[model samples]
Target chain A: MHIPDGFLNIPVSAGAAALSIGAVSLAVKKVQKTIEDRLVPLMGVLAAFIFAAQMFNFPVAGGTSGHLLGGMLAVVVVGPWAAMIVLTCVLIVQCLLFQDGGLLALGANVLNMAVIGVLCGWVAKKATNFLSRTAAIFIGSWISVVAAAAAAAAEMAISDTAPFATVLVAMVSVHAIIGTGEGVITILVVSFLKRVKPEIVEDGACRAL
Target chain B: MKNRKFIVFSLLACAAVVVFAAVFASSYPDGLEQVASKMGFENKMSGINLMGAPMPDYGLALFGAGPFSTLVAGLSGLAAVFLATTASGWAIKRLRRSGNG
Candidate 1:
């Protein structure tokens, strides 16, 4: 869920931006511990994979397409700190080069997509791991994307972009379906990595924070 | 020392994936745009005129009806990754030296 420009007010966006800066700072530091020998290259490949995955957008509803957000993917594959850096990089590229998002609102978008998305996904995975792998995947994927969407909606609502209820309903409803796709994709990809490259999954490569 | 290989490997892999991503990126509106279209809120969204641009879609100005635009978008994303990661790395290094990290 890439948030375009004008969705958030200056104050809310700025506040979120500040918080994002702090979170990213923390992430960078945390990643330093595990970002070396095995994790860095894996993180790079994972970033590329996430970037590539984002390109394959499947149609959702109302003529819109949803792709893998990869917040959960990054967290499960790498770790939260590295995921933060990876996602921030991805969002920045989308905004600056592709012109997919607004420059002014990059911070807010990164906060929602990078920081909140990864953490929520990680928490959900941790919470649901006691269940079946499918359940864990579903819960992780669903919660992560929803959290990002809700954060985006909350930013919009706080910024007065749209009515809070309208934004919430629209953002959350569509993303719920999108989350299913995300969950499925994440689970499948993770499973694949586990099978083909067990080291990436087991070693926890690129873990910063 | 041990982590250096991982960092280098990840960076190179990201570069390779970016190439493929650019070549095959779906030409579909994402979540926000989709919501706007379906909910009829697209008109409410305003556009900006950065660099005297005409067509709003990224493909218009950069590539203009060709794969080059997509390629450039993907490469541009790589550029962003370089800049963002470099900056983040520097920021962390500085913070650590300052005894804050």
Candidate 2:
């Protein structure tokens, strides 16, 4: 769901860019009152983990492989605001280093994948926690990925990159499955971290999980 | 663990993980690329001419993966995390200090 360069028109991209920046700023403000110094490095480490995890592409149905976007993983491991910063770092590195995404389209990519993905993923996790872990992770990840994809597809549609319905279907349907991978990976990683460093969660340093 | 020292250790540990990730990453086309290939847009994929970028294709434009590629991508990811997190932390700190929290 990383919208490469030239996928969206300049105006639509710029609009989404502004929204992303605004959301990040708001996230920082929201977390500042509660953020402790100890959480900073935790967030950074989680970001790096996300960066690495994103490199491993899992095979989806139809022989296509999709990697963990880590928006949910980061949020689950850290808080949402810090996750934003963390995932932003991952996105920037992936784009500049791997040529996997575009430099000019960084704003749109972050908005869709980092901002929308983390926020929606966190909400979905919270909503589904009443169910089993498997169900929670599966549904949470599915919703987040589909939401991000839908947002990206909307941007593309508004930008006239592809027909609205085509982009929506292509992105949402595929990402629906991709979200399952995301959910499982997120739950496993968070569970591992919780076992190793329970204090991070016990102390309220990690909230999104 | 003290806060400052823990942070340093976490950073180093993340750097190590990045190396592992780059090395162990599957060498296959990702979801988008696969979809594009199947959907007939694969031919439209074009290389960007970004000047002097490091570690293109996770391998500095080299053909195959190796320790060098892994190390480079790992280090780059580490640097990015450091820069972004530090900047964000400082910003948060500054905002708090300004009584704007």
Q: After superposition, how far is residue A126 of candidate 1 from its true place, in Å?
A: 0.2
Docking class of 1: acceptable
All candidates' TM-scores? 0.82, 0.85
- How high is the TM-score of chain A in each model? 0.93, 0.91
Task: List DockQ for all candidates.
Answer: 0.34, 0.45
TM-score, candidate number 1: 0.82
Q: Which portions of model 2 show Cα errors greater than 4 Å?
A: A202-209, B1-20, B42-46, B50-52, B61-67
- Scored against the true structure, residue B6 in model 1 reaches a CA lDDT of 51
Q: How would you class the docking of model 2?
A: acceptable
**Candidate 2 residue-wise lDDT, B1-101, digit = tens:** 55566567666766766666666655556655554555554454446735444776666545356867666766776677566766667778678888999
Query: Which predicted model would earn the best lDDT?
Result: 1
lDDT of 1 by residue, B15-77 (tens): 665566556656677777776676676665556634332333445564676566655655555
Worst 10 residues of 2 chain A by lDDT: A200-209
